[model samples]
Target: MTGSTGHTDTRKTALVVGASRTLGLALAAEYLRRGWDVIGTVRGSGRTGLHDLAEASGGRLTVESLEMTDPDQISALGDRLARRTLDLLFVNAAITRGDLPIGEVPTDMFTEVMITNALSPMRVVESLRPLVAPAGTIGIMSSDQGSIALNTDGGQDLYRASKSALNQLMRSYAARYADDSRTLLLMDPGWVRTELGGPDAELSVDESIPGVVETIERHQGKPGLHFVDHQGQVVPW
Candidate 1:
């Protein structure tokens, strides 16, 4: 692919997890538009918007299947992509069970949200970190809601707690791999209008994802973990 610079684009590969629709799908498309080879994962055999993007990508986009909650699926995906080197591995998965206070949340509901939003993403990162290039990036779709220091108006307690847990776990992961050269990012895409963000969200996917991708690209060679928003502004810890 030749870019606007009139030079042949050295294609970088990106694996966008949970990319069937919404923000994940948009991220995949943005990367593809920027001359990157994109592998986007959906949940099942059924067709999705990502499949549509792949069909029109002239072979630049490959669609994979993944159930993020299942460790077996994650391991299987890691094995399947073992030969390919990835420039970016981004895991984007989140769920919210209404606006229930944390205390009122059922044990099962709490477990499901935690696993989908926090544990499963970390599991995927751990399983697939080997496939990423040494100077590549590993990012998770986090939210500003996760910032404890900025939680002035308290609502959506369960969702807040889950994102906070995700951030904390990423911190631990960064600490454990402190010497690793790869860049780690916790990206806050803001309140984009998606199923998860609801119809009343302030920003659309178009408004959020390009900046998110650019932020990731700008931080490519910078080692260590950063918690930042779509515009590359540092989000509070």
Candidate 2:
């Protein structure tokens, strides 16, 4: 039977990337509360929010140390997870430092942002591909800034380019594996009040996640490149 959150009591597995805090933690908690076995990935130890999530999940959750830049670690984790099937895989980790205009942004910083935000998630997906059940889903946390149709003036070049690249990556996955029952989606969580979004953003993480979760539910039967907002509206892609 389904629980209070509409998730079934059946033991499902989910792997959440960048689950140190905020939306990531909230998503993990909601799944655990609904009886899904959750695995959260964080870069380091001593992160308070992750510790709290582990404690709150009551043995239903496991946290793994991950460095997105390191391919070897991702491969090892994939090997470890290969014995079990996964129901959901959420790629949420991304970086945006110094939003200075493109011309002034240091090349190294821009490269790092692309590596973390674009390439890393693809690598994770590749590593974890074997673990996803044929009926499972894979979601990439994407942004509206990535939409070529929506771009007018390109101010935040690095961030915009990175997410746009991610959009392409997700699209490629869908095209190559279209016959596979596993669903692939590029979701825009909207402008949320968080460390990455700042206080002036349009929505809170709490407000965004539930609706995003609902969107995931609604699209459970249909999948491809779904550019959806928190309110379930299709954002331009």
Candidate 3:
């Protein structure tokens, strides 16, 4: 990693945002398995799947609190880990309603989806960017539906719009920091079977995350952003 301003910690460390369950939990667990110390965030004051995972992590994992939608919480999270140097900061955004067309979706529902999927994650990234080592990696959990050029079939409606917005936001963020040596990744983990991905998804978590982790490793220390899939293949913008 290329950091000059981050803390001088020797252990490999990762800050996995929204890590209370599903893909986030799995990713945190995988990072631990790969020999990194993990700090995972759950939204509020309740026991979650991540708590159990943390218990079994043999002290390799620490659970923190964050509600990505809130600026106060984001500020608090930044302060809480300010001195810490993060080897990897992966912002795992969430939520999708149904197959309704964008025109049919309610305004409130659309707002929630866009904020949760696009805006909040970027807020998290901006707040935590200072803590990431210059040699570190920053990632956002994206989906292939975000590909605007690949929209021939026109399914997933608002979900596609949110991810596309996320991709564009990250692209702008990357452009602003183009000279920085840190790696920026928009990683699509495929349609894995999760609460978010639904039961009908083509891939299982066990089948996908290992490749996702590998793709992140491949991008480490590389400057600029890559919109890539779990297998390190680039997706069309």
lDDT of each: 0.95, 0.83, 0.92
Clashes by residue pair, model 3: 1-135, 2-134, 2-135, 3-134, 3-135
How does residue 20 of candidate 2 score in lDDT? 86
User: Which pairs of residues collide in candidate 1?
Assistant: none
Assess the local accuracy of residue 77 in candidate 2 as a C-alpha lDDT between 0 and 100: 84
Best of the two (1, 3) by TM-score: 1
Candidate 3: C-alpha RMSD after superposition: 3.1
Judging by lDDT, tell me the better candidate of 1 and 3: 1
lDDT of each residue in 1-237, candidate 3, tens digit only:
325887554669999998988789889989999989899999889999999988998987999999899999999999999878898999996899988987899999999999999999999999899999899999999999999998899978999999999999999999999898899999999989998788999999988989999999999988899999998999999
Per-residue alpha-carbon lDDT of candidate 1 for residues 85-136, written as tens digits (9 for 90 to 100): 8999999989998999778999999999999999999999999999999999
Please give the range of 10 consecutive residues that has the lowest summed lDDT in model 1: 1-10
Ranking by TM-score: 1, 3, 2
TM-score versus the correct structure, for each prediction: 0.95, 0.92, 0.95
Q: After superposition, how far is residue 235 of candidate 1 from its true place, in Å?
A: 0.5
Evaluation by lDDT, superior candidate among 1 and 2: 1
Question: Whole-model lDDT, candidate 1?
Answer: 0.95
Q: Of the pair 1 and 2, which is ahead by TM-score?
A: 1
Ranking by lDDT: 1, 3, 2
Instruction: lDDT for model 3, please.
Output: 0.92
